[model samples]
Target chain A: MRDEFRADLHIVSQLLVDMAEAVRAAMRQATRALLTADRKAAETVIAQDAEVDSIYRQVEERVCDLLARQAPVASDLRAVITALHVAADLERMGDLADHVAKTALRRHPSPAVPAELRKVFTEMAGVADRMAEKIGTVLSKPDADRAAELDRDDDAMDDLHRSLFAVLLSDDWPYGVETAIDATLLGRFYERFADHAVNAGQRVVYLITGEPTA
Target chain B: MRDEFRADLHIVSQLLVDMAEAVRAAMRQATRALLTADRKAAETVIAQDAEVDSIYRQVEERVCDLLARQAPVASDLRAVITALHVAADLERMGDLADHVAKTALRRHPSPAVPAELRKVFTEMAGVADRMAEKIGTVLSKPDADRAAELDRDDDAMDDLHRSLFAVLLSDDWPYGVETAIDATLLGRFYERFADHAVNAGQRVVYLITGEPTA
Candidate 1:
């Protein structure tokens, strides 16, 4: 590769790493906002989504520029395209954070989620955070086994989701139908957030092994 | 492109189109199963889902092979990657259809939805089907204007969704909470299915104009 092209590739790689970190930060802030019902924290998450979105756009433009200029081949092209998809998943994760925050604002003054449900959500968030953290590692080290472990963690999130729904279905819950709906939607957002993280991890597997994993 | 590469690309493209059509057919069958309370039809939809899943995996494998073999650049690369993403969306849509059909099966013998509710669902299905058809065109033609119109149609689906929920929530409703929950989940599946179709259309716009919408 030419020196200038090599230099641009390094910059692109750095940008991708930084974008993943930004996505992780957004997920953390959003989870905090949901768990604590902190309006200011939620606002911070909401505000940072624009930054994530901007970074996503920037990454995409840079990728397109690289494709046009250097005409990346094989693994290089996979890296660029995978970065595009991971950036999107991260951006949507931010949107889900925004969703959780919006839900918090609406259900404020009244704690819509019971303490037990909150416990389950906290666990789910942890699993999601771990998965998002691994997307970066998976990208830089495409052959790593850590990506596979992230897939395993997604199972825990699914379990939590099932438990949440089971609680909602229980007769002991005297909460109104609206509250149940809110809880169900909230659980779904978290479940989907983790699922996207799993997707990012799976992309890493595909980037390396060239095969889709469950 | 070499003659062999071009031939393979042609085959892959045709398969992608076929997979989308098959998904649409599965959805139609599932919707019919729901409207008519046909357990037999519901089972058929469920059985066909395996075929849809297999086709999606085949599409994924072909796209990955193309990415590795031809190393397509720029627009060609975008088209291949978009095909993979669109295939995933289509497969997920089929699963949602199966979900709807399963709900129908559960409520069979004593029709979960009344004639009025069935009419609403039939109309909603018509709108959803159009959105799916538009998505197929958007993928093949990469037309920005047509893609934008699909977004407007999505709004109509949202309105229908709200109306469905409103009817479910009314005091005049005679069904139990289980029935209400089933309706809510069914409506959600269709709503989300249309949303993904819209996402596919948006990607087509991006592919054509190299600009992001929403």
Candidate 2:
């Protein structure tokens, strides 16, 4: 029974890594769809979110079962419980990507971003992709030091999000209210996506160190 | 030992209820500050969030300690674990309220809502307060049926959020980009505040029914 429980725990960790990879693909496609106005790509990203949700449920069920059957104590208990929250964070990150996809679908054939802000958003998307990659690495390895870097890397995304506001609030701002709202909402989605990645990474740090990130 | 665990569990519940109430008060002050552009009110809301965080940590520590010592199983286990997640949801709700207060602080002396949208936001704030109230009641009692009502009540807030989009997207939108962005983000913060409430309440339902809320 004990060995079986430990094996289940290992399976849960692997499932999260797989889930993270799937979300990364969705994030890439969703950003592409948003930048290029590809409805098909957007639709694909939206549909793929179902897979992430499925994995999330599986992880949740496994955690609950482990808690009930094995009754893991101390660090083992923390690891299982932390896995649940990390899965939730991953699922939410997938939803954020879905939000980006829906934005693309809403403005289909007309890129959701203004031409002037295109470069900035492209950078934001790049940062998001890098962060997702880092998340996958941490999930697979559970390295606290590497996980710690996700936040430092995320500062770029946050700065870009604020820069988006500077553009919108500037005296020379020329975009209509619609474009401004689109940019604001999109910027928020990407920034939050990175934040969730940072959050997930921080959870891994907690799991490894047996200490709260704060 | 089991009886002591039950007593500790009861205390956790009470702490969560009191935490919910404090968060509700913060929500009230933050919304008032946002609509009125009252700097002092916003500042107070901002400052009070620390107490909510402090209470959150206390709840978490108690729950973790209970898990470690009691080794609760089945429904007993579910209650304590659900309490952990619910407390987290509550903490996030408080942070959302703090976000609202900060937005108010950022736009000090200039009302966050446009003149025409004032009535709608007033209604949104009322809906949020009502949801928070229901959450408090349910936290104290832990009734699945009562907790189920939270999602239905949340529909009003969702509708209001949609109404915000309608205003922003309307061809007649007269506000500048900055105001449109502000209203869009503010609308989202309130909508999510209600969402966290529903999430917390749903966890209560799970606790009662011993069933996943999916």
Indicate which candidate wins on lDDT: 2
lDDT of 2 by residue, B122-152 (tens): 8888988998888899888878888898888
By summed lDDT, the worst window of 10 consecutive residues in model 1 chain B runs over B175-184
lDDT of 1 by residue, A1-214 (tens): 6676667766766776676787778777776777677778778877877887787777766866776677666667666666667776777777887787777767665665767688888888788778877877766666548888876888899999888877777778766466666777788788888878887778777777877675
Task: Please write out the lDDT profile of model 1 over residues B30-127, one tens digit for every residue.
Answer: 88888878888889989988888888778766865776667677777666666766776787888888888888888886665676588678877887
lDDT of model 1 at residue B2? Answer: 69
DockQ of each: 0.29, 0.66
Tens digits of per-residue lDDT, candidate 2, A1-214, equal 8798779899999999988898889999998998889999999999989999999989977887788788788888888878888898889899999999999999888888878888889999999988889889988887889999898879999899889899889998886888888888899899989988998998899999988887
Residue B145 of model 2, lDDT score: 88
Model 1 residue A190 lDDT score: 83
